[model samples]
Target chain A: MKLASATLMLSAARVEAERLGVIVCVSVVDAAGYPVAFLRMDGLALGCIDVCIKKARTAALFHMDSADFARVACPGGGAYSLELTNGGLTSFGGGLAVRDRNGVVVGGIGVSGASTEDDIAIGLVGLAALS
Target chain B: MKLASATLMLSAARVEAERLGVIVCVSVVDAAGYPVAFLRMDGLALGCIDVCIKKARTAALFHMDSADFARVACPGGGAYSLELTNGGLTSFGGGLAVRDRNGVVVGGIGVSGASTEDDIAIGLVGLAALS
Candidate 1:
């Protein structure tokens, strides 16, 4: 396992998203859910920025992706939650964890784009660039 | 004067959707954003459930749809701003208002699933069923 900069990883995700013809908002954060770097594409619907960040944070803190949280957390129910249905967290796929070279889960990356699968794939490839 | 059965309007909208091969989530609300009648199609994503509600709320409460609010709310903006991009309110095109026969603007409806245009179309047709 080698090491890479979180900042660099964040930018790489952005680049990859552009290459894929998808405009996305990407978030990189520590295991605690605090942001490392965040970026949202132009015309990316200003509303998506924070949602991506929060989902990334949720994934990092809970050590599970946002959808997983949404699965466990039903409407008006759960221990760890995807309560964003109230509007702050989007559990609609797209969020994933970012692990370091040591095989340790270092942080998480979340993306919002064309579709749920596209967002998740963008995050994985973006993190891969850092590795 | 005659009347529109709230339940009937809801059912008609669902029927129309079935004819179109689109499973949709529909929300009918009073002017206050409270549910007059709400229904989520089988297999509709759970996160989108509340999103339609609040977007309907935002459309009714502020007298504007979620997209309109997002246009005004900034990155970390204000009190009257559209704050849900952080996750609660989806400004994405699935929300609209429903006025009464008296033209008093009594309520609103929101639809989600498929594209933005499709979502809005479902809501409009749903509202039209009441007329």
Candidate 2:
């Protein structure tokens, strides 16, 4: 994905976090899990920095919402222990695959620093700005 | 620094890389050495991914260009072996500090995948876009 589009999505998530009165870290990664853009609200928890990046990477690498990956990564599931791969991944809510209009995966976005539901909501807001 | 500003700088470096016909990676890190933004041109070498980030982190952590840090990190210099600390650092050209109008350091930018001189030039273009 172009850097312009990546920044657009990142800004949208930041706006949503502001609207919800939450400070968060948001990360965008290309299809190969390389960073495209990232931003952390001032005063955010430092530990959330790596988590957000890993979340977006997980989505981009797996081509699935992190929550879905979470389900499949359970003890008896097909991808069990997969989160421990690819440098580390966050198989949970708040990370979603980014696809072009044709439904081809292009990148992924991840949000952190809020409740899991809130983080997912924020990520959705970012994805909605893709156009 | 604001995400808007970070993206602006990142775009400037990317534009420079395009003009030079070099597939490169660029990274921006805040004063605390946390990532603010990053971009890797399509088909860029994977090895440069971490190098660019480390270069930016070196500048941010030391408040000097990575080239200058290289001198200080030489065998008998005061900072010798410092690169092994703080995760890892790249003490070489292509990394420079980001400063505000007051000349206070705010962040840093790093570029990789080209000659050291070309990388530094690209990073300078990025820093020039800060205003």
Candidate 3:
């Protein structure tokens, strides 16, 4: 369960975004829901900050990726949103869970800019590379 | 940019876990940082819910995806966690942003019960399928 360092995570994300043709903001946190790294691309909306954090928390806490929970949530799926106690929680695009070589629940990734799928795509590619 | 639905996301995560032979939890959020779907595999810690939520938040907000950001930030990388006002944000693993057919951030995905990387992978695969 070894986690990648914040430095590598940010740099890789930047590189990946460049390849993907998207300017993205990324955030990383530890297993305890603490921040480890944060990077934002220029010319992005300030609102992205909030979106990124909640995405990270969902990955960290659930031990699951946020994207999975998001599809079946809300009233149609029984509204798990209210079930969660985390007020700062989010179910948006551009987040992913990070793991170490040891397969431990290490950190997370959050992205902004472009579309949600693009955010996820860039994020997955970066994580895959790091892994 | 189409995000996977909860049914497919969960089923795939479940199938992947079966192949991996591990128990896990998963979650998903929407573009607006809200819940879209959620699932808890048996034999998981209750606290994982919080971690997953925060992780998802990081991805959703930053738009860089979760894993990438988890690698950076904190006392070492300049506390981007506190920089954002979102309270439920996490920098952990197991979450990702989901998109629509048009590349809009329609929702998110999350997973648990295993390594964050595995979680990310499962989420990515599911999202990829939907895309």
Highest-DockQ candidate: 1
Q: How do these models rank on DockQ, best leading?
A: 1, 3, 2
**Where in model 3 is the C-alpha error above 4 Å?**
A1-4, A82-84, B1-131
Q: Could you give candidate 2's per-residue lDDT for residues A50-114 as a string of tens digits?
A: 66787788899999998787776645557666756676667567889999999999989988777
Q: What share of the true interface contacts does each candidate keep?
A: 0.22, 0.00, 0.16
Best-fitting candidate, scored by lDDT = 2
Clashing pairs in 1: A1-A101, A84-A89, A86-B88, A87-B87, A87-B88, A88-B87, A88-B88, B98-B108
lDDT of 3 at A53: 68
Q: Can you list the residue pairs that collide in candidate 2?
A: none
Candidate 1 lDDT by residue in tens digits, A1-131 = 12246667667778778888988888888876777777778646444566578768767766677667656554333543344333345444567777766766777788864456678778777777775
Q: What TM-score would you give candidate 3 relative to the actual structure?
A: 0.50
| DockQ per candidate, 2 decimals | 0.12, 0.02, 0.08
Candidate 1's docking class is incorrect
lDDT of 2 by residue, B1-131 (tens): 77888899999999999999998999999988899999999999899989999898888766789998798553334333344445567878999989899987788899999999999999999999987
DockQ for candidate 1: 0.12
